[model samples]
Target: MKITVQLFARARDLAGAEHVELDVPAPGRVADLKRSLASRFPQVSPLVPSLLVAVGTDYANDQTQLSPDVAVACFPPVSGG
Candidate 1:
Protein backbone atom coordinates (compact mmCIF):
# COMPACT_ATOMS: atom_id res chain seq x y z
CA MET A 1 0.00 0.00 0.00
CA LYS A 2 1.10 3.53 -0.75
CA ILE A 3 1.02 5.97 2.12
CA THR A 4 1.65 9.69 1.95
CA VAL A 5 3.64 10.88 4.95
CA GLN A 6 3.82 14.48 6.00
CA LEU A 7 7.21 15.94 6.84
CA PHE A 8 8.03 18.89 9.06
CA ALA A 9 10.95 20.83 10.51
CA ARG A 10 14.32 19.12 9.92
CA ALA A 11 12.71 16.18 8.18
CA ARG A 12 11.11 18.51 5.67
CA ASP A 13 14.42 20.26 5.14
CA LEU A 14 16.23 16.98 4.67
CA ALA A 15 13.62 15.48 2.37
CA GLY A 16 13.29 18.84 0.58
CA ALA A 17 9.56 18.41 0.50
CA GLU A 18 6.47 18.75 2.68
CA HIS A 19 5.44 15.18 1.98
CA VAL A 20 6.65 11.85 0.59
CA GLU A 21 4.98 8.70 -0.65
CA LEU A 22 6.16 5.36 0.68
CA ASP A 23 5.32 1.75 -0.03
CA VAL A 24 4.01 0.51 3.30
CA PRO A 25 2.68 -2.83 4.39
CA ALA A 26 -1.02 -3.01 5.01
CA PRO A 27 -1.86 -3.46 8.73
CA GLY A 28 1.66 -2.28 9.35
CA ARG A 29 3.53 -1.10 12.41
CA VAL A 30 5.43 2.13 12.90
CA ALA A 31 8.65 0.14 12.76
CA ASP A 32 7.85 -1.05 9.26
CA LEU A 33 6.97 2.47 8.24
CA LYS A 34 10.30 3.75 9.49
CA ARG A 35 12.21 1.18 7.51
CA SER A 36 10.32 1.97 4.35
CA LEU A 37 10.86 5.68 4.84
CA ALA A 38 14.55 5.15 5.28
CA SER A 39 14.94 2.91 2.26
CA ARG A 40 12.82 5.10 0.04
CA PHE A 41 14.06 8.47 1.28
CA PRO A 42 17.60 8.13 2.44
CA GLN A 43 17.78 11.88 2.73
CA VAL A 44 15.63 11.52 5.85
CA SER A 45 17.17 8.25 6.96
CA PRO A 46 19.23 9.73 9.76
CA LEU A 47 16.16 10.99 11.47
CA VAL A 48 14.43 7.64 11.31
CA PRO A 49 15.88 6.46 14.59
CA SER A 50 14.67 9.42 16.53
CA LEU A 51 11.76 10.28 14.31
CA LEU A 52 8.54 11.34 15.96
CA VAL A 53 5.74 9.50 14.20
CA ALA A 54 2.17 10.59 14.50
CA VAL A 55 -0.73 8.46 13.42
CA GLY A 56 -3.36 11.13 13.20
CA THR A 57 -2.73 13.64 16.03
CA ASP A 58 -1.22 11.25 18.54
CA TYR A 59 2.40 10.29 18.80
CA ALA A 60 3.03 6.67 17.79
CA ASN A 61 5.62 4.24 19.00
CA ASP A 62 7.36 1.58 16.91
CA GLN A 63 4.79 -1.07 17.72
CA THR A 64 1.78 1.05 16.96
CA GLN A 65 -0.45 -0.72 14.49
CA LEU A 66 -1.42 1.19 11.39
CA SER A 67 -4.61 0.83 9.42
CA PRO A 68 -4.93 1.34 5.70
CA ASP A 69 -6.62 4.72 5.88
CA VAL A 70 -4.85 6.59 8.62
CA ALA A 71 -3.11 9.93 8.41
CA VAL A 72 0.59 9.70 9.10
CA ALA A 73 3.33 12.25 9.62
CA CYS A 74 6.91 12.22 10.80
CA PHE A 75 9.32 14.82 12.12
CA PRO A 76 12.46 15.19 14.14
CA PRO A 77 12.19 15.97 17.83
CA VAL A 78 11.82 19.68 18.59
CA SER A 79 14.05 21.44 21.06
CA GLY A 80 14.01 25.22 21.24
CA GLY A 81 15.25 27.49 23.92
Candidate 2:
Protein backbone atom coordinates (compact mmCIF):
# COMPACT_ATOMS: atom_id res chain seq x y z
CA MET A 1 0.00 0.00 0.00
CA LYS A 2 1.04 3.55 -0.66
CA ILE A 3 0.53 6.44 1.74
CA THR A 4 1.28 10.15 1.75
CA VAL A 5 3.44 11.30 4.66
CA GLN A 6 3.77 14.88 5.86
CA LEU A 7 6.81 16.18 7.68
CA PHE A 8 6.30 19.00 10.15
CA ALA A 9 8.52 21.52 11.86
CA ARG A 10 12.07 20.22 12.29
CA ALA A 11 11.11 17.00 10.62
CA ARG A 12 10.38 18.84 7.39
CA ASP A 13 13.63 20.71 7.63
CA LEU A 14 15.60 17.55 8.26
CA ALA A 15 13.91 15.74 5.41
CA GLY A 16 14.22 18.69 3.07
CA ALA A 17 10.62 18.30 2.00
CA GLU A 18 7.16 18.87 3.37
CA HIS A 19 5.79 15.60 2.16
CA VAL A 20 6.78 12.22 0.75
CA GLU A 21 5.07 9.14 -0.57
CA LEU A 22 5.84 5.76 0.96
CA ASP A 23 5.25 2.30 -0.35
CA VAL A 24 4.67 -0.17 2.46
CA PRO A 25 3.34 -3.65 2.74
CA ALA A 26 -0.29 -4.20 3.49
CA PRO A 27 -1.09 -4.30 7.24
CA GLY A 28 2.00 -2.24 8.01
CA ARG A 29 2.22 -0.47 11.35
CA VAL A 30 3.55 2.94 12.31
CA ALA A 31 6.82 1.44 13.53
CA ASP A 32 7.37 -0.33 10.26
CA LEU A 33 6.74 2.84 8.36
CA LYS A 34 9.21 4.72 10.53
CA ARG A 35 11.91 2.21 9.73
CA SER A 36 11.18 2.51 6.05
CA LEU A 37 11.37 6.29 6.21
CA ALA A 38 14.68 6.18 8.03
CA SER A 39 16.07 3.78 5.46
CA ARG A 40 14.88 5.87 2.56
CA PHE A 41 16.14 9.12 4.01
CA PRO A 42 19.29 8.29 5.89
CA GLN A 43 20.01 11.93 6.53
CA VAL A 44 17.01 12.07 8.82
CA SER A 45 17.53 8.76 10.58
CA PRO A 46 19.12 10.38 13.59
CA LEU A 47 15.86 12.18 14.34
CA VAL A 48 13.51 9.28 13.99
CA PRO A 49 13.74 8.20 17.59
CA SER A 50 12.39 11.52 18.79
CA LEU A 51 9.73 11.91 16.15
CA LEU A 52 6.03 11.55 16.73
CA VAL A 53 3.73 10.05 14.17
CA ALA A 54 0.12 10.83 13.39
CA VAL A 55 -2.50 9.21 11.28
CA GLY A 56 -5.12 11.43 9.78
CA THR A 57 -4.41 14.13 12.35
CA ASP A 58 -4.44 11.97 15.46
CA TYR A 59 -1.30 10.96 17.32
CA ALA A 60 -0.48 7.33 16.83
CA ASN A 61 1.66 4.73 18.57
CA ASP A 62 4.31 2.54 17.04
CA GLN A 63 1.93 -0.37 16.87
CA THR A 64 -0.86 1.65 15.34
CA GLN A 65 -1.96 0.15 12.06
CA LEU A 66 -1.67 2.24 8.94
CA SER A 67 -4.58 2.81 6.61
CA PRO A 68 -3.90 3.19 2.92
CA ASP A 69 -6.16 6.21 2.54
CA VAL A 70 -5.05 8.02 5.67
CA ALA A 71 -2.56 10.84 5.59
CA VAL A 72 0.41 10.36 7.91
CA ALA A 73 2.43 13.11 9.49
CA CYS A 74 5.84 13.00 11.16
CA PHE A 75 6.27 15.63 13.85
CA PRO A 76 9.28 16.60 15.87
CA PRO A 77 9.16 18.09 19.33
CA VAL A 78 8.11 21.72 19.41
CA SER A 79 9.34 24.46 21.67
CA GLY A 80 7.24 27.43 22.82
CA GLY A 81 6.57 29.62 25.77
Candidate 3:
Protein backbone atom coordinates (compact mmCIF):
# COMPACT_ATOMS: atom_id res chain seq x y z
CA MET A 1 0.00 0.00 0.00
CA LYS A 2 1.25 3.48 -0.80
CA ILE A 3 0.43 6.36 1.49
CA THR A 4 1.34 10.03 1.36
CA VAL A 5 2.58 11.32 4.73
CA GLN A 6 2.75 15.00 5.52
CA LEU A 7 5.10 16.35 8.16
CA PHE A 8 4.64 19.57 10.06
CA ALA A 9 6.41 21.95 12.44
CA ARG A 10 9.44 20.40 14.09
CA ALA A 11 8.82 17.10 12.40
CA ARG A 12 9.11 18.74 9.02
CA ASP A 13 12.36 20.41 10.01
CA LEU A 14 13.82 17.17 11.30
CA ALA A 15 12.70 15.14 8.34
CA GLY A 16 13.97 17.83 5.95
CA ALA A 17 10.86 17.52 3.85
CA GLU A 18 7.23 18.47 4.15
CA HIS A 19 5.92 15.20 2.76
CA VAL A 20 7.03 11.75 1.73
CA GLU A 21 5.59 8.74 0.00
CA LEU A 22 5.76 5.42 1.82
CA ASP A 23 5.19 1.94 0.62
CA VAL A 24 3.70 0.00 3.50
CA PRO A 25 2.59 -3.58 3.56
CA ALA A 26 -1.03 -4.65 3.68
CA PRO A 27 -2.65 -4.78 7.14
CA GLY A 28 -0.18 -2.24 8.51
CA ARG A 29 -1.20 0.17 11.24
CA VAL A 30 -0.12 3.75 11.89
CA ALA A 31 2.41 2.58 14.45
CA ASP A 32 3.96 0.20 11.98
CA LEU A 33 4.42 2.99 9.47
CA LYS A 34 5.96 5.15 12.15
CA ARG A 35 8.49 2.46 12.98
CA SER A 36 9.35 2.03 9.35
CA LEU A 37 9.87 5.76 8.96
CA ALA A 38 12.15 5.90 11.95
CA SER A 39 14.22 3.10 10.53
CA ARG A 40 14.50 4.85 7.20
CA PHE A 41 15.24 8.23 8.75
CA PRO A 42 17.19 7.67 11.91
CA GLN A 43 17.57 11.38 12.51
CA VAL A 44 13.88 11.61 13.23
CA SER A 45 13.58 8.52 15.42
CA PRO A 46 14.19 10.33 18.69
CA LEU A 47 11.21 12.54 18.12
CA VAL A 48 8.76 9.74 17.40
CA PRO A 49 7.33 9.56 20.89
CA SER A 50 6.29 13.21 20.78
CA LEU A 51 4.67 12.98 17.39
CA LEU A 52 0.97 12.83 16.61
CA VAL A 53 -0.66 11.33 13.56
CA ALA A 54 -3.75 12.31 11.63
CA VAL A 55 -5.78 10.27 9.21
CA GLY A 56 -7.27 12.59 6.63
CA THR A 57 -8.34 15.48 8.88
CA ASP A 58 -8.82 13.66 12.18
CA TYR A 59 -6.34 12.66 14.81
CA ALA A 60 -5.40 9.01 14.83
CA ASN A 61 -4.08 6.71 17.54
CA ASP A 62 -0.89 4.79 17.10
CA GLN A 63 -2.76 1.57 16.54
CA THR A 64 -5.15 3.06 14.03
CA GLN A 65 -5.56 0.92 10.95
CA LEU A 66 -4.47 2.54 7.70
CA SER A 67 -5.61 2.18 4.12
CA PRO A 68 -3.66 3.11 1.03
CA ASP A 69 -6.29 5.54 -0.09
CA VAL A 70 -6.28 7.67 3.06
CA ALA A 71 -4.22 10.81 3.46
CA VAL A 72 -2.06 10.96 6.59
CA ALA A 73 -0.05 13.56 8.44
CA CYS A 74 2.64 13.33 11.11
CA PHE A 75 3.44 16.28 13.27
CA PRO A 76 4.46 17.63 16.62
CA PRO A 77 1.90 18.98 19.09
CA VAL A 78 0.34 22.22 17.97
CA SER A 79 0.16 25.16 20.35
CA GLY A 80 -1.96 28.26 20.39
CA GLY A 81 -3.59 30.69 22.76
Candidate 4:
Protein backbone atom coordinates (compact mmCIF):
# COMPACT_ATOMS: atom_id res chain seq x y z
CA MET A 1 0.00 0.00 0.00
CA LYS A 2 1.11 3.54 -0.67
CA ILE A 3 0.77 6.23 1.98
CA THR A 4 1.06 9.93 1.43
CA VAL A 5 2.66 11.67 4.41
CA GLN A 6 2.54 15.40 5.04
CA LEU A 7 5.68 16.87 6.50
CA PHE A 8 5.75 19.88 8.77
CA ALA A 9 8.22 22.15 10.57
CA ARG A 10 11.71 20.74 10.81
CA ALA A 11 10.77 17.50 9.13
CA ARG A 12 9.61 19.35 6.06
CA ASP A 13 12.88 21.25 5.85
CA LEU A 14 15.05 18.19 6.34
CA ALA A 15 13.20 16.26 3.66
CA GLY A 16 13.06 19.21 1.31
CA ALA A 17 9.50 18.27 0.55
CA GLU A 18 6.15 19.15 1.99
CA HIS A 19 4.82 15.73 1.17
CA VAL A 20 6.29 12.31 0.47
CA GLU A 21 4.89 8.95 -0.56
CA LEU A 22 5.97 5.79 1.17
CA ASP A 23 5.31 2.18 0.29
CA VAL A 24 3.95 0.17 3.16
CA PRO A 25 2.05 -3.04 3.56
CA ALA A 26 -1.63 -2.76 4.41
CA PRO A 27 -2.49 -2.72 8.14
CA GLY A 28 0.91 -1.32 9.01
CA ARG A 29 2.03 0.23 12.27
CA VAL A 30 3.51 3.64 12.95
CA ALA A 31 6.90 1.99 13.52
CA ASP A 32 6.83 0.57 10.02
CA LEU A 33 6.31 3.97 8.54
CA LYS A 34 9.22 5.38 10.54
CA ARG A 35 11.53 2.72 9.22
CA SER A 36 10.51 3.38 5.65
CA LEU A 37 11.04 7.10 6.08
CA ALA A 38 14.51 6.59 7.48
CA SER A 39 15.44 4.20 4.70
CA ARG A 40 14.25 6.48 1.94
CA PHE A 41 15.20 9.84 3.39
CA PRO A 42 18.23 9.59 5.57
CA GLN A 43 18.25 13.29 6.28
CA VAL A 44 14.99 13.01 8.17
CA SER A 45 15.91 9.95 10.17
CA PRO A 46 17.43 11.83 13.06
CA LEU A 47 14.09 13.24 14.02
CA VAL A 48 12.42 9.87 14.45
CA PRO A 49 13.19 9.65 18.15
CA SER A 50 11.48 12.94 18.84
CA LEU A 51 9.13 13.12 15.91
CA LEU A 52 5.41 13.35 16.28
CA VAL A 53 3.35 11.22 13.95
CA ALA A 54 -0.34 11.57 13.40
CA VAL A 55 -2.68 9.09 11.80
CA GLY A 56 -5.91 10.73 10.90
CA THR A 57 -6.35 13.50 13.47
CA ASP A 58 -4.70 12.01 16.51
CA TYR A 59 -1.07 11.73 17.50
CA ALA A 60 -0.07 8.10 17.29
CA ASN A 61 2.50 5.93 19.03
CA ASP A 62 4.77 3.38 17.46
CA GLN A 63 2.22 0.60 17.82
CA THR A 64 -0.73 2.48 16.46
CA GLN A 65 -2.31 0.76 13.50
CA LEU A 66 -2.73 2.59 10.22
CA SER A 67 -4.54 2.10 6.97
CA PRO A 68 -3.10 3.13 3.64
CA ASP A 69 -5.63 5.87 3.10
CA VAL A 70 -5.38 7.47 6.52
CA ALA A 71 -4.15 11.05 6.73
CA VAL A 72 -0.58 10.95 8.02
CA ALA A 73 1.53 13.83 9.12
CA CYS A 74 4.93 14.12 10.82
CA PHE A 75 6.80 16.89 12.52
CA PRO A 76 9.26 17.46 15.30
CA PRO A 77 7.68 17.77 18.71
CA VAL A 78 6.56 21.32 19.35
CA SER A 79 7.41 23.60 22.21
CA GLY A 80 5.75 26.86 23.07
CA GLY A 81 6.06 29.59 25.62
Error of 3 at 34 (Å): 0.7
Q: Give the candidate number with the greatest lDDT.
A: 4
The alpha-carbon lDDT assigned to residue 56 of candidate 3 equals 89
Give per-residue CA lDDT, model 1, range 1-77, as digits (tens): 88889999989998888988888888788999999989988988988989999999999999998876889999899
TM-score: the better of candidates 3 and 4 = 4
What order do candidates take by lDDT, descending? 4, 1, 2, 3
lDDT string for model 2 (1-81, tens) is 888899988778878999888777889999988988898889888999988998887899999999888889998776778
Q: Model 2 lDDT vs. the true structure?
A: 0.88
Query: If both were scored by TM-score, which would come out higher, candidate 1 or candidate 4?
Result: 4
Instruction: Supply the TM-score for candidate 1.
Output: 0.90
Per-residue lDDT tens digits of candidate 3, residues 1-81? 888899998888888999888777879899988987787678889989988999989999988999988999998888979
Candidate 4 Cα misplacement greater than 4 A, ranges: none
List model 4 lDDT by residue over 1-81, tens digit each: 889999999899999999999987777898999998988999999998898999888999999988876999988988778
In model 1, pairs of residues that clash are none
lDDT accuracy of residue 45 in candidate 2:
88
- Off-target runs (Cα >4 Å) in candidate 1 are none
lDDT assessment of candidate 4: 0.90
Candidate lDDT values, in order: 0.89, 0.88, 0.87, 0.90
Give the range of the ten consecutive residues with the poorest summed lDDT in model 4. 23-32
Task: Specify the highest-TM-score model's number.
Answer: 4
